[model samples]
Target: MDELTEFIQSNPDPRELKRALAVQMVLQEYTYFAIRDVLQVSVGFISKWKQAYEIQGVAGLALEHQGSVGYLDNEQRQAVIDWLKAKNYWNLNELQQHLEAVYDVVFASKQSYYELFSAAGISWKKTQKRNPKADPQAVERKKQEITDWLEQHRHQISSGELVVFFQDECHLLWGDLCGYVWGKTSERIEVPMSNERQKQTYYGAFNILSHKFFVQAFEQGNSEFTIAFLQALLAECPESRIALIWDGASYHRSQAVKDYLASVNQGLQESEWRITCIRFAPNDPRQNPVEDIWLQAKRFIREFYHLCQSFSTVKWLFEFVTHRQTFNFPKASMYGLFS
Candidate 1:
C-alpha cells in the first residue's frame, strides 16, 4: 500500500484528502487492483467510491455525506419565492426558465418544480369568480332594501299569500357545458363532439324562495331577452303578486324594464299581479342568492357533463343541472358566509 493513499484513508480528518485521492486515481488511470490495495479496500468498493466522486464532485466523497442530491441553496430558492409573490402568477415552465436565467441552476425535472410550488402552497391555475371591482356598498344597500321591503310585507309572507321572487339574468354558452377532465401538464386537447350545432346563449331565472326555474334560448343579452326572461318567470310562477330582487345592471335599470313592471303593477291592481324590483348593491354578488345558484349550477355542469361538446349537449347539461339544483334547493340554500 502507498503512503499517500494510506494517509488519505486513515487521517484524523480525511474528507478533502479522500476527494483528492479519488481525483488523482482517475487522472493517473490507476488499475482497480492497485487503487484498492493502496486505499486498503476491496477493488469494487474503491471503484464505487471513485465513480461516485467523479459523478457528484467533492461533496459526494465524504463518508457522512449520504450521497443524496441537495436542494437549491436557501438564497437561490428564496429568490424564486420572492419572484412568485411579486408576480402573483406563474406557470411551471415560466418559473423554471426564470430560475435558470437568474441562478444558473437546473431543476432535475418538471416534477421537481411542481413539488416546490406544491410545498409552498401556490395555486397552479386561475379560478373563475366575480370581478374584484364589484361594489360591496352597493350590494349591502340592495340587501337592506330587500330586507326593508320584506319587513313591510312580513304579514303577507307569513300568510303564504304572496311570493317573493329573486330574478337575474344568467347566460348559458355552448362551450361552457363541458365537464372537467384530468388535464395534462403542458398540453390540453379538445375532444370532438358527436352533436354539432351553432352556438346558442340562454337567459334563465330562478325564484330564490320557491326554487321554480325557467330558461329560454336567446341570440343576445339585450332588453328583449331580459323582458322575455321576466315573462317566463312570471308564467312559471302562479303567485298573484310577485316581488323581484335583481342587480342594478344597466338593462335591469333601463326604461324598458321599468315600464314593464309598471304595466304589470297597473293591470294586477284588480287581481293584483304586482311586481316590485329591488336593485342590489352595485358590486356585491355575495348577498344575492342567485349568484350562489349560478356558481353551484356551473360546478355541477363542469364536473360531470363529460359527453357535452356542442350547443345541444350544453342545453341538455343545463337541464340536468337545473333539475339537480332545484331538487336539492332546501339543502343548497343552507349555504352562508359562515358555511
Candidate 2:
C-alpha cells in the first residue's frame, strides 16, 4: 500500500497512476474483477498492469507520456503560429530559444519542442530559394505580358512564322555531385576527386515549340559570349522571326548586346522576320524552360561524372547530351504559368 501510494505520487500521468493503483489493489488480495468494475478498465488491462508490475515493478508502470501533456495553451500556440507565419526560416534550436525567451516556457527535451510544433500543425520542410527583392507585381505583370504575346502569336508559331527560344547558362564541375546513395549502416561510399574542381560553362537555348536545342561551350559567360551566341542563333533562323527569352543578367543587358540587337532590328518592321529579345521577370527561373534544360544536363553530367575527368571530357559530355535532343520541355508546363 505504501509502495503503491509512493508510485502514484511519483508518477505524473493520471492514466499510468490509475493502472498502477489497480495492480496494487490486486496485489493486496483484491479480486481483479472488482478492480476492473470499480476502475471501469478491462480485465485484460488489469492483467497487463499485473504483468508489467511483475516484470519491472513500479518503474515499468511509469508511462512514457511526459511530453504528451503539452506545454503551450491555445493562446500561446496561436502566438507561435503567428510568429512562424511572419518569417520564412526557422530551426529547432532557434525555436527552442524563442519559446523560452518569448513565452518563458522551457521544454524538457528538444523532442518535446518538436512535438509541440507538430501538435500546432507546424512542420519542417525544405523550401526553394527565392530572391527576397523580387517584386510580385512586376512578376505578375510580366506573366500577363508573356501570356498576351503567346496568345497573339499562337497561329504564327503553329505555322512556323515566329519561333520562341529560352536561353540560359550553366556550369559543370569535375568533382562528385554529392547526392543520395545506398550504403550499409556505418559505411560510406567514397568519391575520389582532385583538389582543383575543374569546371566548364555552357550557353544553351531550347526552342519550346519545336523541341530543338542549341548549345555552345563558352570560356566565360559575358557580353562577348552572349553577343556571339545571339549572332549564331540569328544565323540559324535567318528568315523566321526569333524571339529569344532570357533572364536579366548584366551580360544580357550590356550596351554592346543592346547595340547588337538594335542593329538586327534596325530595318525589320513589326511584322517582319528578325531578332527580338524578351526578358524573364527578375528572380523567376522556373518560368524558363532553358533552366529545366540546364538542370537535366547537370543531372546527366553528375550521374556519369566518373567518365568526365578532364575539362575536354566534360565539354564533350555536355555537347553530346545537349545535341542529342533527348531533353523534353513540356508545352503544358509553360501554359500552366499563365493559368
TM-score of each: 0.62, 0.61
- Scored by CA lDDT, what does every candidate get? 0.60, 0.73
Candidate 2 residues 1-339, lDDT tens each?
576678788855666766787888898888988987787666767787788788887776765445544377879887887787676766775675566434545566778777766765678664668788788888888877887887888877777778777788887666535444456769775555664377677888877676778888788889999999988888887777888878999999999988988887787786773877888799867667777776676677677766755656666777888863745546424643321
Please give the range of 10 consecutive residues that has the lowest summed lDDT in model 1.
330-339
Model 2 lDDT at residue 114: 77
* lDDT for residue 22 in candidate 2, whole number 0-100: 83
lDDT of 2 at 212: 78
- lDDT (Cα, tens digit) per residue for candidate 1, span 221-315: 77777787777666655564666766777877789977887787774553365666666666656666666666676676666555655556666
Error of 2 at 180 (Å): 3.0
Q: In model 2, which residue pairs have backbone atoms overlapping below 3 Å?
A: none
